[model samples]
Target: MASSSISNAEANTNQPRETKFEKLTKRGRENQAKEVTKMEKTRWTSDAEQQNYSVKLVEALSQRSHGNSSPAAEVSHVAVRETADRLLAVAAKGRTRWSRSIVMSRLRLKLNPNKHKKQKKPKVAGDMRSKKPVAVAKKIPAVERKVRLLGRLVPGCRKLSFPNLLGEATDYIAALEMQVRAMTVLSGLLTGTESLAPQFDPLGSGRS
Candidate 1:
């Protein structure tokens, strides 16, 4: 009878310990689920966190076997792959949501007519006092005479007097002489026959 009672006490003591271990295991599983849910939430909000969780989860699975190669390792690898796939899906969903938000914002802006108009005054013929105005020709400035452009001359030579044409011919001759002098200066510089620092004249030396 005493042996039976001792056996019962041992069984009772072991039962509480086993129950505690079971509770601990259950709590661990619950905690793991909570952690996964939290990780999923973060992945939905942030790409960086999603990547980090994927890496961490894979690393945890890989380290579970402690450098031993076996069927257990293969199982761990499979688990890691599955978890990564799920997390990647979550990340993809998040990216899709972000894309939808951007598209919607663009559509809203496009649909707003008030945004297309601004402070620019509209052109109306009734708002103008006259359609055209005439002015007398003025003499070209000395600075303007030295500068030339292809499309700037008045059509039909109307701006030129005989004396102006003579002056233009003189200017053309002067330009030709200046070009010859510039070539001579460049050749002298190339042959190292000219002084390096007399006047700061780049066009004459043809450096450009």
Candidate 2:
């Protein structure tokens, strides 16, 4: 009986020490978790800043409209638009870092950053009229400078071009509305706020 009592006391003493060691380990892990969370917050803040910069770049590029400026101004505007488009493409999602780097390289080749000052004439390369006498057209006649309203180039690509700044703003707002609608639908599914019924069930299990 004396030996059994001695053994019981030793066991009780060892168990408490083990418990204390475990508690210390758990506290260490909690501290590490806090450190990781702080680092993630910093990383997220940096990403947000980059995204905001990209958005501002897009807005700056969109300011180049036909009606607002002369053909000479349009040349400079095209340069800015092209450069901004390059940056926007870099900011595009679902692309590898290497691929984005390649795109940036190509853009750098195409966009002459030093060519910022307004040039002599418009840079677009489409013949508006069939054929013209070289000497007669040496002095480019002043044509109607009205920008095409709501210009759409292809199917499934809405708001492809806009006449002015207001139209561009409207296009962005419309895009935001679409995103909000998509988020609403997704939130409904994620939160179980809306029931999603099965349209057809071969096994007769109606639960979706």
Candidate 1 residues 1-208, lDDT tens each?
9999999999998774557888999999999999966754443334233334434444545565556666455545455444444443343443332223334444565699577467876688677554443332136554455443311231122245555544444433433343334334444554777663223333333233
Cα-based lDDT for every prediction: 0.46, 0.45
Prediction 2 global C-alpha lDDT: 0.45
Off by over 4 Å in 2: 1-54, 58-81, 89-95, 98-104, 111-208
- Give the range of the ten consecutive residues with the poorest summed lDDT in model 2: 148-157
Give a tens-digit lDDT track for model 2, residues 129-174.
7567787665654431122222231111233333343333443343
In candidate 2, residue 143 scores what lDDT? Answer: 33
TM-scores of the candidates are 0.19, 0.20
RMSD values for the candidates in order, in angstroms, are 36.9, 23.1
- Backbone steric clashes in candidate 2, count: 0
- Model 1 scores a C-alpha lDDT of 0.46
